[model samples]
Target: MLLHFISDLIRNPELQRQFSRDPEDTMRRAGLSEPQREALHKGQLEPVMKHLRAELASLELFAVVWVKAVVQVGSTQPGIAAPGSTLALQVLGDFFTTGAFAVVKLEGADLPAVTRSVENPGQRGSVLSCTLDVPANTPMGVYDVVVVNPDGHYGVLPKAFRVE
Candidate 1:
């Protein structure tokens, strides 16, 4: 049940918004167990993830970098990108602040990672917007999106986007 809820939360932007607005209520509605609820409420993902790992030994896992942060790729056309394209990113989280730096990278395909830095980022409310330039010579493949904040905290979204 927890696993199902998490899957839904990742795929459904509406559910993500709902969770962001009122996490406790959304978790309750999702019928999460008391312990699961407590763990999530405290932002302690390791215990919950450990339980999930034990439960799904054979299944591939999907994870988010920060429970509170949602990264959206592309402003006009979401998630689709090409080599040499300028990708627009919007990060929604309470942790983002004005003037902080963020490092965005695409890592996968057994290739050297493509990275860009968002220096002196701008934040409005809980949203931070930045752009990353995908190098023209970058290899075409699916890549995991990793974002590192100024405090050295990072989040990873596995297989986040594809380069064609």
Candidate 2:
């Protein structure tokens, strides 16, 4: 929840403005805990970094640049796909506004990455949906979903899905 709140702040300018005007009310409305609010109020990143299990430096960078993207699968769609199949993916994140594009990659250890372009992206609110063609020769393993945003910021969601 803390990470999500941070992502919201990074992606939404209105929220940032609101935070600057009234931080306590903004944090309270965001449902942040007392410790989280206090830490943020004091301009401390240590507690946030600890909650994310990330180093301070990297967290700082992420807070400035990256928006968290979550790939939706399993409930309404298959999370696992065979090679050569098309995976219908819905990536939930901010900053995917007008004229934005993303380069989505399926990356696995010791395997060549499978890259797909999300051109003419279909967006509903913060969700961007696209059909990604999994290459026939792709290896069988869990793959991380790496999205490179139009503004050059990128984020990796590890173990997002699997190729059978």
Identify the candidate with maximal TM-score: 2
Candidate 1, residue 88: how far the Cα is off, in Å: 2.4
Instruction: Pick out the ten consecutive residues of candidate 2 with the lowest summed lDDT.
Output: 68-77
lDDT per residue as tens, model 1, 1-164: 67878889988999999999999999999999788888777778798897677646634333333332433322212455688787665544334433433333455333222223233232323444557567788788766655545544545556665778
Model 2 lDDT on a 0 to 1 scale: 0.57
* Clashes per candidate, residues 3 or more apart or on different chains: 1, 0
lDDT string, candidate 2, 75-150, tens digits: 2134577888776666555444433333334543332223333333323234445566677887888766554455
Provide TM-scores for the models: 0.38, 0.40
In model 1, where do residues sit more than 4 Å from their true spots? 1-77, 99-125
- The predictions' CA RMSDs to the true structure, in order, are 14.8, 11.8
lDDT of prediction 1: 0.58
Quote the lDDT for 98 in model 1.
39
